[model samples]
Target: MTSPTTPGVPPPVVDLDLGGRTALVTGAASGIGRACALRLAAAGAKVRAVDRDADGLETLAALGTEAGGAVEPQVLDLTDLDAAEAAAAGADILVNNAGLQLVRPIEAFPPDVFHTVLTVMLEAPFRLIRGALPHMYAQGWGRIVNISSVHGLRASAFKSAYVAAKHGLEGLSKTAALEGAPHGVTSVCVNPGYVRTPLVERQIADQAAAHSLPEDQVLADVLLKDSAVKRLVEPEEVAEAVLYLCTPQAAFITGTSIALDGGWTAH
Candidate 1:
């Protein structure tokens, strides 16, 4: 006779079943944010993708439709609090993914550069969360996922502002999770290693010029050198992580920094 299935274990469920839920993802025009918009849409959630780039946002909306899903595209500068609040109205999930990074030595890091990075990366997310929490509390269910970075968990050279913003985002997530707990809302931080996107591509080009080395070698040796996998993360891989956390199985998983860093910090 076959033994009964264990109580704690069940069959694998790949699809997230997010019907009736609405997820608002910032920076959804491209890269990991774009991947996340598509992933959440495919999971059966209504999507609202926010970005400054109208063209890219439209493209993402079309991709969502092609994936048997659909998104309402909103063109807005996330740094503007009014726009962020307007966009977040009635949303059940908030993905704070809009960020800007400018890498240079501290001395060369202009004050203007710092302001832009902080405003976009940290302040916008803070405002978005603050704006979304009240609605989420009233609804009795919500998810706030902040996309930090491996640099947030640790540190690296020539990236002071970006690192600081990421670290602060993690702190914000923890605090938000603690407060949202009583209201049945959830919050989490997703820290991914460097992925090959246009953003990262620009970084690579800038690094090549600065270090006088080939871009490929810089990526292979410097970026992923300490990582166990020694490879840049794929956008789709990060998207999978986002969907995993959106599932009911992750109900108890909040107030944590989940890393998709190819074991970068495991060393």
Candidate 2:
């Protein structure tokens, strides 16, 4: 990669800041959501971390303190409509990041798995966004960052449920953006390619079993095959994109899907 400006000159700048915002991040106990929470808190936002795992949320709060960020942990499941509404009670920024992945051929997929994935990735986001509408409308400003995946834009074999749910969530986000635009609210979905996390790490063994390959080979040959970067994307990288969207500079940006896929979707 090369800079477009003169080699000796500094590139143009974007002053991205998220100070004085109240944020609610779902699935914030770990992975990309936790990373976003930490980043926002560091940027001086009062972050409310929401997750089902109490222990993980506590750990995230500690990490925020360690980084000198303001964060409060909340334990609840977005799958419950009332809980979803209550979680976003006073949030100006919402990051709908909770998700689940299942690896199964379509014929082998059951309704339970499909419903579970859809509920988390699609329905939950919809419920929360709908719940937060009045609050944002009252304030006349907000940012809704839907954390989707590259799978939402593109698909691979044996990920039917997850892909479907993500695709739906992307559509939902677009519609939300269109409706929220005139009200000074903006919505965008950040789609990233394969990320190295505990959930993704769990997929190694599953991939190994499904493809009849060793775990190491699954990581090397399967997941990295179409990734131009040739490495698993860091959770913090996705968080950076989320942080960017939350800034005043991105106030004009909405209703678009941003791919942080490391060229996986470029071709």
Best-performing candidate as measured by lDDT = 2
lDDT of 1 by residue, 184-243 (tens): 788999988998778898888777766778987889877777788877889899888888
Segments in model 2 whose C-alpha atoms lie over 4 Å from true places: 1-13
Give me the displacement of residue 110 in model 2, in angstroms: 2.8
Write out the backbone clash pairs for model 2: none
- Error (Å) of candidate 1 at residue 200 is 0.8
How far is 180's C-alpha from truth in model 1 (Å)? Answer: 0.3
**All candidates' lDDT scores?**
0.86, 0.88
How do the residues 1-267 of candidate 2 rate in per-residue lDDT, one tens digit apiece?
656476644345655556778999999999999999999999889999999999999999999999999999999887786788777876899999998777888998888989888988898898889877788888889999999988889988988998999999899999999999988899999999888777798888878888999888997798888888888899999999999898766888899999988898888
